[model samples]
Target: MWKKTQPLSHEDIVAIYDVLLGRRPESESVIENYRRMGSAAAVVRAIGQSGEFAGRRMSSPFHHYHASFDAQEVMRRHAAPRLEPRDGHLTNFLGVVIHSKFLPGILGDRAGQVEDIPIPANWHADIAEWGAALRAVELARDSFTMAELGCGWGCWMNNTGVAARRLGLKPHLIGVEGDPGHIAFAREACASNGFAEDEVTLFHGIAAAAPGTALFPRQKTSGMEWGLEPIFNATEEERRRALAAGSHDELPMIPLDEVIGDRERLDLLHVDIQGGEADLVDSCIDVLSRRVAYMVIGTHSRQIEGRLMDSLLGAGWNLEMERPAIIRLSEGAPLTLVDGVQGWRNTAR
Candidate 1:
């Protein structure tokens, strides 16, 4: 009777069949629940908006996009001792103000990265997770050095150093930025944090790729925030809000190969240059291929998702673990960045 008196359209019929036959665990049951919940467009749209929606895509809707790459492919692309799931999350979100008043103005003339750094409890949770990861890598390696690419105001570097101290690890810290204002702020952060001279490096301009004419898009409509809007149509005001929270940008314009001497000696690398991962990765092909022990990247490129796994595989690296790039949402619901935490590593390295 149920099959004979169905009102579901041909498209819906085909979709249900596809989900039942070719999709995820308990696809038949999930589809049944969807049917019971009502086959309204609004329902589907709402479901699409939820973080659970992508999980469905990764399951049932995957056939439409990703050709089934086997477990070996998954391992070959994303398997390693990643930096941590919570890397730079707070820094990218709110490190500026936290480090702004605290950072020293006279940098390159100070000692350890910084002191007297403060963070809220919630923010500190993320900081703690990331800091612990950084320390683990630093302790495991010899002569640890880090480059904060596109580092604005040195907030990420400064907050990280302070957080590291809390975690009881002190590796060499550097702030690479093109903005003089941020460089000054970073210096202040360092001095305020009580960093001794020679312990911190501040590479002002021309990092890892972008040489001259560093362009920062006014902290509004940044690819980092705006690229996320399509799923939920985030406006420019939110960019302003994030900017107000201090997420300025100065992409690393030089190649790691050209700048750093040895890749093997490098420990943990933190990269947050808006959405410039493609160019950055392309330019630092050797570093991405050689050293790159632990990495945390925030990318919005659809192109990256399609080819990212393959790119890492070709470099002989594998994606070992990953998690959702959870973004705080307000207007309607929270938006969890789909392509999240693809950690790749090479054991043979």
Candidate 2:
């Protein structure tokens, strides 16, 4: 619905920076320079072609394939030893082997199949998530440290860690999940991928604003449940009742600050904690800005996406890429059909 020929206004120019560059203008002079372009479309073109923007794009591991989704070319550039197709393991395009037992819900269908180099469409994640997570690894120095909250079988950790290892960088991975079964899966996945015990840590808990306990639903079927969120603020008696009822288990809640520990630099923080992502990120903005270099968050709603933009951008984080949540009309209100994805970079880091 955006008009290309619309005359640029002061507010519109500011929004251009927020939407395109993911930050506020440096000064009035910068806005003035953009205003001289006269049309919104011209300003957009200028920003999109700028070296800063181009540099950000080039940082992604998928940079070469962005222009053309040529999966073969990408595999050729970043190939590992071709993995043998097996019944319980599937190799991704990056040659990272994944365990079939960790595939959740419909993703389990991929089990026991021979996986060729996958195009972006066939991949589990969209381009933005793939680019963001891998970009964090690409930007690492001699060492790469990453943590994943709500990490299902440590998928991102293993994938990104392998990418970092390929570049000769030492990788330290951390995974936190509410499900104990998934935590076991994470441990198995990491070990299978050749990470030493000292290089990997798995936590059976939830990431929250503070340390506490939350009620997480006990999954009856392993690998069949996904998107399970913990119920915060449950009383001790309620948690006991739920536990006795065989429906939920009390999980330790660890704050982001404690999760990262004394790590001087965390290359990536991947979060997909269902609908609680915004609040968790907002509460840990200071830690995020100081320690974490990049983030790829799975947003559950449009409101969550907006809150994330407001909180992170307000704290000087750049919006590297984003795909808004898919919404559909429902009886009560609008419902999110599919979760949105947002990739953020902390400029202060």
Candidate 3:
């Protein structure tokens, strides 16, 4: 339905190279070289054929042509462990090797698909998604505040830190997780990944509408995959009954404003609070409108997804991307609900 109007001018080609490479051409001679190549396509081929781009291992994952972001240095930092590059997956996963310079790395566990770690099956999709997220933050600001609610193992935090550092920005990162054990693990992971105490901070509480107690499912001793954990806004009697039954753990639920008091501006916020996304967004709409420039929230239900879409759009945030989850009800039944990550950027403010 759509087609290119005309060949891109030399200036246009150079601009594209600048955005993809994150830097201007070395000299005017580079532009002249591209000009001598004739068409835009030829210029692109000439650039790809150059030794500098060739050394970067130019790869066009979705196309036949090879393209490079000039991110070899960052990619080397995310080299797969020895156990990886095998048939299946690694038992002890360390970090993800994303080829996009926008996101340098993602520290996560391979035992289970915890964070966006590259796998033998979905490594390309993983790299594209994580890289897009980091690119969103990069476009929003060079240096600014960032926070991750439900910061599972601090994978996104590390990714943000690494990307920001490469961009010459010293960003302050905050990690908030309701899981006590996860909070400890996240702290250690952050420290191990070169984050100093002053550069990164951790909060051990669930982010809710207000400061109060919320019922969280206590992790079982054997497994740690509670990606669908929910926080209930239950009555005191209900809370007591759950505690008496020894099923749920009582955790302090604090609002984002309280935890991030007086931050002034939050450039980006990544929230994956399992099923609590809708309630948390509703409860902290004011704080979000005031401080947050961009938000990427993971939803678990159609109702939650609609609520978030309405609330953020009403507050002047624009939807940037959405990846919906699909699951079958039974062996032969149709998929029931759609839920996944939704990205929004505040375009008005």
lDDT of 1 by residue, 71-139 (tens): 223222222222222221222222222331322221112222222221211212222223323432433
Give the per-residue lDDT of model 3 (tens digit) for 220-333: 541133253545678888888889998788878767887676877787788877567787788788888878887866666556778988888888888766544322243554
Two-way TM-score contest, 1 vs 2, winner: 2
Ranking according to lDDT, highest score first: 2, 3, 1
Superposition TM-score, candidate 1 onto the true structure: 0.49
Worst 10 residues of 1 by lDDT: 222-231
Best by TM-score: 2
Report residue 27 deviation for candidate 3 (angstroms): 60
CA lDDT scores, all candidates in order? 0.42, 0.73, 0.56
TM-scores for every candidate against the unseen true structure: 0.49, 0.76, 0.62
For candidate 1, the per-residue lDDT at 68 reads 16
For 1-349, candidate 2 gives per-residue lDDT tens digits of 0112234567767766765567898899888877765544345545654667555643322222222233234434555655666567777766677776665323355665555443332335645566667777776888999999988788888989988899999999999998888888888888988999999988888998799888988987656455676899988788779999989988899888888999899999999887888998888888889899999898888899999989999999888767676444556665553456787888877
Off-target runs (Cα >4 Å) in candidate 1 are 1-97, 100-139, 159-170, 210-214, 217-252, 262-264, 301-303, 325-340
Number of colliding residue pairs in model 3: 0
lDDT of 3 at 163: 62
Ten contiguous residues with the weakest lDDT in model 3: 99-108
